[model samples]
Target chain A: MNALNRKKEETFKPLGSKSLLSRMAKYRFLYLILAPALILVLVFCYLPMFGLVIAFQDYDIIGGITASEFVGFDNFVKIFTMPKFTKAIINTVKYSSVQLFLGLPFPIMLALLFNELRMIRFKRIVQTISYLPYFLSWISVVGMFSAFFALDGTYNTFMATIVGESYEAKNILTDAENFLGILFWTNIWKNIGWNSIIFLAAITGIDPTLYEAAMVDGCNRFKQVLYITIPCLLPTIAIIFIMNTASLVTLNFEQVFGFQNIYIQEETEVINTLVYRQGILNAEYSLSTAFGMFQGAVSFALVCITNFIVKRVSGVGIW
Target chain B: MKKSFGEKLFDVFLIVFMVLMCVIMIYPYLNQLAISLNDGTDTMLGGITVFPRKWTWSNYDTIFSNESLIRSTVVTVITVICSTILTLIVCVGAAYAIKKKDLPFRNAIIWILLLPSYISAGVIPTFILFRYLHLMNNILVYILPSAFTFYNVIIIRTFLSSLPVALEEAAYIEGANEMQILYKVILPLCKPVLATVALWTMVASWNDWTTTLYYVNEPSLFKLQYIIQQIIKQSEVVQKMVNDSALTGGSTSVRARPTSESVKAAAIIFSTLPIICTYPFLQKYFVKGVAIGAVKD
Candidate 1:
């Protein structure tokens, strides 16, 4: 692949030296093909970026971005001092840290378990079932979970029966203590199969000859996996870990919103939801945009820092 | 190789574990289906686990009869089809253009396109932009913003770059222009990847309620998922009322009406049905597409 890229680069060097006008004329068709997407990106993506200037302004719907009064850093200062914003920041960190620590390993273990299954047909069927949840929208997943875990729902009824009628039914969805646990478990259930695909692909890429050699050396299946499979999976694992770590602040808005209720809003609120509430619902556009900008900056920093550290430590980074 | 006692025990454990995992994954949908099919009033009495106790189609009938739900369904269908077709055209065209390695300023253009995936301009700015563009409360809100994602562009570009350049060259030599080669030769070969992306866009547009929540204020413009979300919220309130009434020995008038819980379940199932029905046949292509996407070049 590197050689192919290098060869293409060599061939394109002369084209690169051509005059700008000549090159433009020569590749007019390609440029024309690219125009629609370029224009859309400019209007939607880049234009909104220019609208980020409203974060520094006291933005109102009437005056809009251009006419809004520039407040300099007042919005940022207000968000920093707000209690709700602080609570949201704390909750975001707590939930995502839990997710990062617990959520990262399950997929790797699932991939290993999947690889160990000798019956190809059973493995395929199980995989199909596992991947089913990933396709469902967060609305459906949260709705289904809410029904199952409602006070008069299936889970509570089954629990009551099992405990011989003394057990009290709990609405786990609404309970603050149990909300994070529900999020963690449901996230795992939805993503484990889909997430394991890369690791499984990596395992498949491992040389069969190494396994054959391990067998000749009388290594057990467990030992072979521990020594060979895990080692072979390190680079892919490192890359995924870095990516996950970088996005630690950005929780899935739809999932959190679907499960959110007045009873547990304090515990469930995150930056994304906070932005929606303040900006859209409360109409505090400048403050919300500042909050969002802060979140984006922190996430960007995390990505760079993690990528740098991983590159230094293991010579594997997203770059 | 003959299995030892421990290995055989391990096999049994693995099989049982896999079966249990499958059950856990599948049980929620089946439970919802049961609740949706059951008589709404009876469903509130609980213990309708895997099968409906008092079977009835009233829940679905109610959903189909509701004017707003029917409207939302139509809106969602139109949005999905329009968005998917638009995304395919724009992304495929950009991917084809980017596939030309010698295209001037290729690296700069690619970076410009890909930057948005990493850093968004946040919702408020985007909302303001939409207001300025006159896209607020418009159906085009769903179709326009999603037309260009660099991830899809890269995926299609990767697929295109992998194909033998010989076919395109042959077509070019036969007096076919670039657009003709792309339409005639390239598109025919890209069906699998295109299907994968189209399915992705379809599911995304269909499931998106946030666009409605954030952008459109007109109730007439509500999409299916947003309607379901509203139903879920309303049902929660009603459930609370039912619980409160039972505690206070109040009138069972709330109970007389078909329970909103059942209706909520039915609405959810109705909205999810299209994806569920089509996924089995298309799952392989998606799996392969995701694998290609994960290992970025």
Candidate 2:
């Protein structure tokens, strides 16, 4: 038996040790099919990662990335000193925290309410209407808001009726103080139904027997929801919460840029818009790149940390 | 079982609240439509709610007549079609390749593709790369950069793996090669997921003005959303449109002088019409797509 095993191993060794070229040729069709996507990602995604070296350089348009002078940590130090950069960070935290506190619960509540609906047809119609805004781009949402909140628009007119001609028309879209509130509310409005989908799906996946068991135990509908439904949804909620926490520093660029104006730039200047202004508008490429790298590093660290905690707590995470 | 009085009250309150929420969701679009249809000159007076006081087609007429607006609409349509098709082909192919368990370096290929989705090289690096490649200010910038999304590939691959292996094996036994098997057997089974991804790509492409904002400089390559962005951000674009209307005074009637507000509303409505028209029919697919994405995550 030992001699026969040895012979079998020796016979299979040559096939297992076949050269890469022959193996590649054997799977040429698979490789051929994958080449375009691989090449595209290499050029557009991977190659640019090498270009991040400019974040440590004094990038000039004429000299470009290759000839740019190496500046080491100077770009990072410069951005750290900039008040605008500091303000951007603060604004990002403020906006994201508001979104985290208020914006997060709205969807969960909406999902719970949706699950409580007895009429399927009405529920479907409401859900369809609610998800409509998520499909529209931020540009469209901003455009619609601009029209509705223009100086002489419907909002002002409605205010005038309530205040009886003492009401001065205000452009809420451009109100610096109200901008964060607008961001919070608009986010909820746009994403409440869509974001509730996971929670709703979780609700559906709750074992029906648990509900029947609760009914036998004389638990009311609300009690059943409180005891069984909420507990069941905790895992899904924790996973989503971790994801959201990970993205706390990264504001949606499109939404911020669309809603931003000169009047509200001070309030709405996020890291993303600041980067756009510095890099694209002012052509301060290195400074913007450094800032971008800082944002990326912080976001990655946050994701890793949150993912670790969630995995430890629940044994499930984004990984 | 019969509902208690409290439950009955809660249901009534819930229905009313939901109805109110639906109104909040929908009324903005209705208001915009009313503003768009209202006379451009009269919209400045500001009481247009759900219906136009003085109905006119001049806002849309102005939109159609403006050369830049028309060009942008054409550009958006072309980009949407080209990018959606390219994305479907690239993502489907990549997914199929990755679905092969014995494919050499399969795990390595997946990591290479997916790492970018989480850890990006940031915006400036990407912009510089585009500039170096001469994709800046080029139309290919729109279609190429977004053609191979890792998330879409993962979604497609997951769907493909869920399909029974016997289907592909049966085709292979009939003398079908890998490509033929993929084309003849696998492609037919992937319609639902493909439709979901296709809709997502089309909507994303149609609504993307950022590529134009960051890369393209040529006025002719400006997309619908970017033009609308300009109209909103800079009063000059609206002024330019008004001036263009005055220049083409012989074509349009004098009664339809477009105000900045009405023109902005009209431009917004024009861009949003495609989504608003198709979203109800496509809502289920989007919901399913989100569910699939959630399950994967």
Candidate 3:
């Protein structure tokens, strides 16, 4: 029996226990597929994160962060005291809500409408043209809008024609108060169509039989949409809402900064543009660092709260 | 239980309303096109013109003549090329790594990378970090933080994990190693999803201007969007003066008179041409890429 067992063990050893390393070698191609992306994340994403240490010190070019003063929360304290910081926080929250309200529903509405179009050609054309605006640079859009809104430009031209009185254009760009609302609406015009892609997909995924049954039951198109479409899209809507709320303080910097003016600073200022002006332009590294950390904290909290609520209500949380 | 005439009227009205909405959506773009192709003189009249008074290619000619325009193209092209390669690399690696159902810490690593996308670090800290690295003026400005969009990875990973694992096992059984199996097996199969991701990353990079604002100051390194933005601002100032001169003298400089709005229209077309031209052929890919928002961020 011992002789038979020894021979069997020896025969199995060569094929089975070659080594754990050799076992992983069998799946080596899987690792190779992953290599390029892994290395890039390390160099760029992970590398910059290590640079986050600059958040502690008074980071400067000539002095470098290490030799510069480390005032331990002083930078954060300074950020809280800045008037512009408070204004930016308020404007960001306001703009974000407006974005959520106006921007969020538009795509879903567009998708539902497009899905209902009886003519495929018209649907394609509308979808194509609507999506085209998404590709246009915010700068160009703002430029075209400024042209239309100018006193002698298109909007006022139409306005004067209707009202039978000449209205000189006020400097809307330079005016501080009206800037944020304009920013919010322009964002809607720019992003709504592109955002509709997800909702469109979610629409297509709805079971056709459910629609057929509803139609047979004497439900019209609008009723079917209210009952069938919106509820089916609830998951996507809930997700995007939470995502939107999570990043509420992070404004679209390109759009805001492109359209901003010194005179309009009170209305147009966002946390991101503020960071650019204060951190890069002014070189107040400590103040900028603290401000950034504060922004990060608020956004993080928002995300956590959103996740908790989503988990409790919908059971579809991102753990 | 039968249908009512009021309901039918409402349905017809809704359809007509939608058709009109489509007309409105498309009209502005056509107006811009007409203004672009028109000779400078008719455009500055600035009233709505369905067609150009005198059509000419001169507006596009102006864009082609300028060295700054060409320079912006070069900068924009390089950023797109380098950034696309970088994005594919990071997203593929992370996606591939997280794909293994039993891989240790896979979920944790994915969650870490994902948190950044949802909860931003804000512009100030990211800028400060860039400043600290002395990368403030570097072209790396456009490349680094954006290279690894988490949304792309999750989409790619989801697509990859959905593939037949049997093909991979079959290659392994044939005595091929991991590299051979992956190159000969998985990558060729991944063309659809990869193409989807590539198109999106390209558009994102091409339309980028905000990154160019923070990380770069050199005119030579400015992306096309930034340069186009500069021209828009310049034309705005120049056109305002032309408008002023026209009001006073009943005439304006020959170049500024016909060129300002016409050229402005041309520039918009030029900036968007690459996307418009290439996008249709790849529209099928886009439906799949919308999976980007599905995963998160």
Off by over 4 Å in 1: A1-19, B236-257
Clashing pairs in 2: none
What's model 1's overall lDDT? 0.87
Better of 1 and 3 by DockQ: 1
Quote the lDDT for B51 in model 1.
Answer: 94
**Tens digit per residue, CA lDDT, model 3, B17-36:** 67676555555556667777
Candidate 1 residue pairs in backbone clash: none
Arranged by TM-score with the best first, the candidates are 2, 1, 3
CAPRI-style docking class of model 2 based on DockQ: medium
lDDT of each model, Cα atoms only? 0.87, 0.88, 0.72
TM of chain B, each? 0.92, 0.97, 0.85
Please report the interface RMSD of model 3 to 1 decimal: 3.0
Expressed as tens digits, the lDDT of each residue in A1-319 for candidate 2 is: 9999999999888877685557777789989889989999999989999988998999878978778899899988988788999999889888887898668778888999999999999999999998889988898899888888987788999999999977889898877888888888888888898999989999999999999999999998889889999989988888888778746788888888889899889767999999999899899988998999898888888878988988998887888
In candidate 3 chain B, what residue range of length 10 has the lowest lDDT sum?
A: B249-258
Binned by DockQ into CAPRI classes (incorrect, acceptable, medium, high), candidate 1 is: medium
**Candidate 1 chain B: 10-residue stretch with minimal lDDT:** B249-258
lDDT digits (tens) for residues A1-319 of candidate 3: 9999999999888866565457457445555655565555555555555545666776666876567766677666666677788878888888877777667788888788778776787677667766766777788777666655654456666666787766564546667677766787677677766788888888888899999999999788789999998999998888777777765877777788778755676556778778778877887756665677677788778878998898799976666
lDDT of 2 at A73: 98
Give the lDDT of residue A217 in candidate 3.
Answer: 92
- Model 3 CAPRI rating: acceptable
Instruction: Please report the candidate that would top lDDT against the real structure.
Output: 2
DockQ scores for all predicted structures: 0.72, 0.78, 0.40
